[model samples]
Target: MPPHPRTTSPPRARRRLRRALACAVTISGVLLTTAGTGHADPYAAPFPAPSMTPSTLDARYATERRSIEQALRTAHGVGDTGRARTLGAFLRPGRRFLDFDPRGRGQAVEVIGDLASARRVALLVPGADTTLGSFDQRPGKPWSTPGGGARAVYTEASRITPRPGLAVVAWLGYAAPKTLSSDVLTDERAGQGAVALHRFVSGVHRVNPAARIGLLCHSYGSVVCGRAAGSATGGAAWRRVTDIALFGSPGTTAWSASALGAARVWAGRGGTDWMEDVPHVRIFGLGLGPDPVSGRFGARVFDAGPGGHSDYLAPGSPSLRNLTDIALGRPESVTRA
Candidate 1:
C-alpha cells in the first residue's frame, strides 16, 4: 500500500523549510554582530542628587551645566569635534538638565517646562541607538530624539485649549542599545533601564509632589517602562505614575496592561510602522512579548494616522496631538483608532 499523501514528506517541502531556517539564522547573525561591544563611559562624573524643593532645582541645573561645560572642553581637547558640538548646545542659557554625563554614549535628563509648578508631567523614554551624537540628528528621523521629541510634545501641549500646567522630561537616563545588537533581543538592558527610570520618577515626585505623572515610551523604551511598572520593587514611585503611553513599541514583554501596574495604559502604532512585522512572542528570553496594540492586550488604542515609526511626534500630526492630550491629562479629547 502506498503512503497517504498527508503522511508523505516531499523533498521540495523539506528544502523550503531548510531555506527558511537558513534565512532566519543569517538575519540573526547579522544583528548579533554588534553584541557585547558596549563599553562604560570613562569620562563619567557624578553630579548632585536630585533636589526635593523647587528652590533648589536651579542649583541642581547649575551643577549639571558645569559638568556639561567641562565635558565639552574634554571632547574638544580630544579632537572629538562631533561630541564637542553636541555638548556645546546644552551649555547655552535656558537649557536645563537634571542629569548630564558625557561618558560612553552619554545620558541626560532635560525638562521642557517648569516642572516645579507643573500639575501634569510627562516623561519620555527613547529607544535604541540613542546616543549623544544622535540626540538631535538621528539620520533619517529628525524630530525623534529625546530632546527634539520632548520639545515637540511641549509645543503641542502649549497649543491645547485651557492648557494645564504640563511639563515634559526627555529622559535619556540609561545606556540604550547603540545598534541592532543582541542586547536588544533580551531584557538585560531593560532591567537596568527600569531601575534608572524608577529612581528618576522618585526624584521627580520629590520635586513636585502634587504633579500627576505620565510616561510616554517609544520603541525599545516601552520595554524599559514595562519592566519598571511590573517590577516587584515597584512601590510609591509606580503609584505616582498614573498613566503610560506606549508608541511604536516592539512589545511590552507583558501579556496585558494589568501586568504593567499602571492605572490607565494607552497604546498606538503608526499605520505604516514596520514594527507591525516583528514576531510578537517571547521564548528563551528572546523576542519582545505580546503586542500592546493588539486587542488582547486591553489598552486604549488611539489614532496614530499613517506615519512611519519616527513620525509619531511630527509637528501637527494626529499622533502628536493625541500624545499632547495624554500629557495634559485630557483623555476625553483623545481620538480612538
Candidate 2:
C-alpha cells in the first residue's frame, strides 16, 4: 500500500476546519428568531441616560441607585418577580450602578472600585448568552455569565492594578444574543449595541473628562465595540478611549488596526482559546472579518496564556493582568505575545 499522506492539511487549514465544524453545530441556532426563542423580553419605558456629568461621584452613584431602586419597585408592583429579585440583590448593601434599564433582557452599568476618584476607568463589554436572569448568577463555575464575567474580570484587575486609582464598569447596556440564535450571525445586533455604547461612553466622559477610559471588548462584544468605533457620536467621544483591548475575539469587523477608528487597539487570545481556530472569513456578512491577533491585521498582540474560550478573565490569570496593565496605560508592564 502507498504511504498514507500523513495529515496532509497544514495547521492553518486544520484550524479552519475545526472552526467550521464547531460553527456548523451552532449555525442551526442561528435560524431561531426572537419569537422562536420561546420567551419574549419584558419591555420597560425608556429610562433617561445620564447626560450631564455629576459634580460628585457620590451624587452620581446616588442618582443611579435611586433610579434602580425605583425600577425595582415598579417591577415588583407589576409582578416582574425575576427582575425585581435581580435588582434587589444588586441593591443589597454595597452595590452601585451608573445606569440601569430593566426592559428587554436588562441593562446595567455596574461599577467596581471608586469610579469618582479613579484616574483610570475600564469598561468591560461582554459577549453573548447574557441576560437579566444570568447577570449575577454564575453557578457555572469557570465560565461566567456576562455580569459574572465582568465582575470576575473587575475583581481580578483590581487585584493586579499597580495604581489604586482605577475602576471597572460592567456595561450590560444592550440586549445580547443567545449563544444558539440567528442574532449571532449578523452585525444587526452589534449595530444597536454600538449606539448604546457610544452614548454610554459619552456619558462617562461627561462624568469624568479627566479620567482615561479603556475598553475591554470580549468575544462577541468585540463586534459591538467595532461597530461603535466606526459609529462614534463624535471624534471627541471616540478619542476619549486610551486603548481598545480585544480578547477571545472572533473578529473585529475591521480591516486593520487603523480601520477600528479608535485609539491604540490591542488583541490577545488564550492558548487554548477556540477562537484561534475560527476562520477570519466574512461571508455575506454572516461571518467575522480581520483576525485581530494575526500579524497582518496589525493590532498590538498581548500574551493571554493557556485558557479556554471563557478563561481569559479567570481570576488571577495572566490574561487578566495583561488586560489591567493595558487599561492602566502601563504598556511597558504588559506581557506581549
> Which candidate leads the pack in lDDT?
1
TM-score of each: 0.88, 0.85
Q: Give the per-residue lDDT digits (tens) of candidate 2, residues 49-108.
A: 445465655666777777777778788877988778888887877788777767667777
**What lDDT score is found at residue 295 in candidate 2?**
94
Residue-wise lDDT of candidate 1 within 1-337, one digit each (tens)?
0111221244877646644653364247446655345654446585665564677798898888888888887887778899988888877778899988887778899998999989988999999889888777766556789999998898888778546689899999999984346776777889999999988898888888888999999989999999988883655656878889999887888889899885689999987675665667789888779999999999999999788788899997999999889888889999999
lDDT comparing candidate 2 with the true structure: 0.76
List candidate 2 stretches off by more than 4 Å.
Answer: 1-17, 36-43, 46-50, 56-60, 70-84, 140-143
Error of 1 at 94 (Å): 0.6
In model 1, which runs have C-alpha deviations exceeding 4 angstroms? 1-31, 35-44, 48-52, 139-141, 232-234
Worst 10-residue lDDT window, candidate 2: 1-10
